[model samples]
Target: MIAKPLAKIRCLKSAQCLDETTEDQIDFEVDFVFPLTEFDLQFVGCEVINFTRKIIERSQPTPKQLIGLAHALHALECLPAITPGISVEYGLQLRKGDDEFAEFKYWSVSINEESFEVTSGGSVYDSSVGSDSYSGFKLYVEAGSYGYRECSDDSYGWIESTVEVLNLGGVLEVSDDSGRGCIKGTDE
Candidate 1:
């Protein structure tokens, strides 16, 4: 099958502050589009923080920033092109956000168009959400990096959130801010 260009893929991520004690986030949905026969989709999520520092005006992300976004987009959009019947793995990394700038990185699994299931094994973190085992599709960027490349480390303690597409019959495990864990779907 001919793989579609990156431009053909549709991506949506939003971030906002709901209140002082909580933040509103929307990261995943069904019917998400996947392009590429065997590529990766990075920079697919977003987050909303308290806006601690002054953000540079009119300054779009730098080449590094654009790369982080493009890299993630490429990885996620092509989730269906990887080896069929096999789970694909991805790695995401980002530098600490300072008053000046932040660094990011993304290493993702192959795509498999013949299948709709895309599984990713990695860690995610943020203030609102604690870290934990993460795997799911439909990543939502509520604020930081808008689901772009982010730093990963065992020292970060727990994973914040991870977005992945699972073929029907797969499983999804997630953790929330209150430090709760939940599993979705069951293999029957």
Candidate 2:
């Protein structure tokens, strides 16, 4: 079965239009209400907070308890962005032990590369990931366009510097996006 996020997160996408009433930047706010499976994220905002916050709900603590993410969090590691002339669309998928992949909000976040300045939000992380143990999760990324090992000058691509945001346990590698975007497994 495909794993699903426990909750829904809304985030600010891009507002690249002038308002008809006033010549001010129109605040275009909308909810990407589509269901997110194990780990695909579309805009990358509150969900990242939801994930990083690690606001776990335990049966003992009034049926819902918030833990970890006690202190201020470090910069997010899973924020995937569209690079100019880089990739038209970018996505991250969580891999299961079954070798089947679970997707976050959506499979691919269509990037508006042409827009002068398009900004979106990405949840840092959530659930019990980044641990030596199961952390209850893993991720998947195919080769060809999605291979991260392809990092270097002639062969290298842009890499996201990452830091584990959980208060308690974290993985061996800090950067979630192995090279381009995403934390593969507990070891990664």
Candidate 3:
């Protein structure tokens, strides 16, 4: 068993927007090679947000981000090395989109009843969906995607998108808009 990477939030957080219009966010996304390629689990990507501010990087990641990354890496690591994209093997199930096909390179870490699963093909999972328990926490890892809203308290907030947790070819590397931040799977 591997200890989850130590990722504690670096800033003060609130349960609700406190007069401030901006709130930080974190998202999780995992990428696999076309679905059923035979290979070993490479890495899990995680990211943090400071509302377009220069504050997140591989050195400092939030637990909300790390936890989801940990779980995703854990589940997929259980999968035996296969040569195809996503195949029906063991408990691993391949689900396709309902209407048409879309090019979604990453899968969202969906949580239900406190458990998590890697899924895509809908709304491209992000922060707003399961952000109740995650302070400044969001996962969809859609690069450069954010959702803005007026909080009930009248303050505004910026919800950041996903963090790609699994990449088959190599680590899914990402950078913030400022180009000063990056998200990677390794603690180093």
- The number of the candidate with the highest lDDT is 1
Give the TM-score (vs. native) of candidate 3: 0.19
Q: What is the per-residue lDDT of model 3 for residues 62-112, given as tens digits with 9 covering 90 to 100?
A: 554343334333333332111111111111112223333322333233321
Instruction: TM-score winner between 1 and 2, please give it.
Output: 2
Give the 10-residue window scoring lowest on summed lDDT in candidate 3. Answer: 82-91
The TM-score values for the models, in the order shown, are 0.18, 0.19, 0.19
- What tens digits encode model 1's per-residue C-alpha lDDT throughout 103-140? 22222322222232222344444445554445333322
User: What are the per-residue Cα lDDT tens digits for candidate 2 across 23-123?
Assistant: 13322221111222233332234443343333231112121111112111111211222221212222222223322322221122222222111112222
The per-residue C-alpha lDDT of model 3 at residue 166 equals 20
Model 2 per-residue lDDT at 73:
19
Off by over 4 Å in 3: 1-59, 81-188
The global C-alpha lDDT for each of the candidates, from Candidate 1 onward, is: 0.26, 0.22, 0.22
